[model samples]
Target: MMTFIESVQQALQYDFILKALLVGSLIAVSASVLGLFLVLKKYSMIGDGLAHVSFATVAIALWMSASPLLVSIPIVILASFFILKLSEKASMHGDAAISLVSSFSIAMAVLIASMARGFNVDLMSYLFGSILVISNFDVVISAVLSLVVIVTVIFFYHDLFAVTYDEEYAQAVGMNTKFYNYLLAVLTSITIALGIRIVGTMLISSLIVFPTVTALQVSRGFRTTILIATLISVICVILGVLFSFAYNLPTGAVIVLMNAIAFGLAFLAKLLRR
Candidate 1:
């Protein structure tokens, strides 16, 4: 068996592996941070919903011979706002709006796939993730967007926290709660669009959900929880990608399993503490 050090060195030799690590780590960090706010605000399903939307957009992009990231980004961002509109104007509940958008997107994707007869890449790859197939261009674009998500969160940290924890209070205190809420939704949309490449359409939402929930089990206080979640997210993505490469397993599945295991450990720790 290859030693751990040897395995790390071997994986780093491939440009594909290098790209996966760079892109996945950046996405993991942004997802974990945004996830903290989403989970706290009880809007976690938006990630999953947007993931499905991304799938449809990917299908559309592929059918048109366009780049998935280029097409999915703007469409998913619009879908995110549409979800918000549904809840505010139609009085549809958040989950209901999510379900409507998610189901519609999936249907559209299936229809498009059937119409086109095929895509350049395997549909399963997009659904389940195969980061090795990601092109050099994707790595650059994903890196830039990931950093945008992270920096925006840091810059608006206090305002986001205020809006997340107490929307009514935030509004009363002269904060633009509506803008922040939309901002949160837009950020989630971008993260989900990028995350589809990391963990696939099926498992991408888990990247947004698992780490923060796990961190909650083991930590308290907003800042502390965010710190722990970011660590867990980055570690899991790096290890998961490396492990899958070494073992020839499915990359997305491995990453999600790592997250599940971490969640289990945190849950166990919570039980023991109680």
Candidate 2:
């Protein structure tokens, strides 16, 4: 394994790797913060499902010769809205609805991608992510989306807290619990879309779930949980990128595996402390 200094130098020396590190870190931080609330709400799978849907949108965009981001954003937003509405109307398990959407979207994407020949590498990148091929546009988009997510989360922190901790009580106290809940769903869909290029559909959910899960092992307070999750995510991103570079592995999967290893270590530490 390369030393820390070697890893840092590698990240600094290669322009493509540098952009991937920067964009991946931005997405990791965004996912960790929002993922805390998602974990608490028990809607973490929403990110996974949304990533699938975004995959479908990207495939369609490729077919139509349009900007994938432009095509994906509206679809994700609409899907989130419809899912929230359907959840309220049908009284179905939210996970079931998300799974249904995920399955359908994946099927559609497979069909579309099959029709679009000469797409093996592009499809693989979407499936597993291509950190080494990250462009300047990807970095810019990740940074903008991260900023929006962070600002929105901070702006409505109290409402989010009240709703997550006690929805009935929040409603009793005149908090727009429903609004924030749906808003979170929409924002999470957007997050997933923005993250798909960074982490890929296959491993995107890891960024959403692992950091928050590890943080919850030790943190009981909301602020502490978010902060710990962010730290865990950043560390995972850095370590994952370095490992991928050294071993010539898939960056997204390595990042996610790093997160899983981090969680395992944290769990072991907690058990030992007990």
Candidate 3:
């Protein structure tokens, strides 16, 4: 059996593992950044809902023999718009709107899975993630999308902060609240789609939720919170990948467990301070 250091060196020798690290780290940073605003706006579950939508889109794409990432991006973006419109125009509220769409998407995914010859390995991989199976194309797509998300967030940071902390006040001051809302939804859709490749549909939202909450236990300012969350996310992803490689464990599950441990430690630190 290889020692821990030897196992990491061996894993790094593979291109796929390197790609996983690059893409996973990018996704973690983007997710954590977006998650801060989402959690503040009481829209954190939007990630979960969009993730289910991505699952359905992936299933549909597979059924048609198309690229899942390519097909899922547009559909998930549209679904994000639909969720926002449903909440604002239909008076459904955010969580209720998310739940409505999430349940429907899960049903569609199940229906598609059943209609196929059977539950295929591809579908299983998407549901639980097969990070080691990530290809060059996956790496490229993840990099491009993650870059777009992070850059867009930075470009509109102040607007997002205004809308997140006080949408009514933002609107009262003549800010385009609706446009920022849509921007957030669209960015989140892209993040969810990209993240599914690493963490899968079932666990992707954890990447969005955990780091922000953990950071909140210690950080007081918004900027500081995002900084802490991004650092925590990157560290967790690196450790998770290395540990999973060493133990031959599931990458996505290990990552989420590591995040959970981080959260527990953060909570303990908070309690100790008080």
Q: Return the top candidate by lDDT.
A: 3
| Residue 18 lDDT in candidate 2 | 78
Work out how many backbone clashes candidate 1 has.
0
Name the best candidate (by TM-score). 3
Best-to-worst lDDT order: 3, 1, 2
lDDT for each of the candidates?
Answer: 0.92, 0.85, 0.94
Runs in model 3 deviating more than 4 A are none
TM-score of each model, paired residue for residue: 0.97, 0.95, 0.98
Q: Write the per-residue lDDT of candidate 1 for residues 140-162, one digit (tens) a residue.
A: 99999999999999999999999
lDDT of 1: 0.92
lDDT of 2 by residue, 131-150 (tens): 77767776787789788988
Instruction: Return model 1's CA RMSD, one decimal.
Output: 1.2
C-alpha lDDT (0 to 100) for residue 271 of candidate 2: 99
Stretches of model 1 off by over 4 angstroms after superposition:
1-5
Per-residue alpha-carbon lDDT of candidate 3 for residues 215-249, written as tens digits (9 for 90 to 100): 99999899999999999999999889989999999
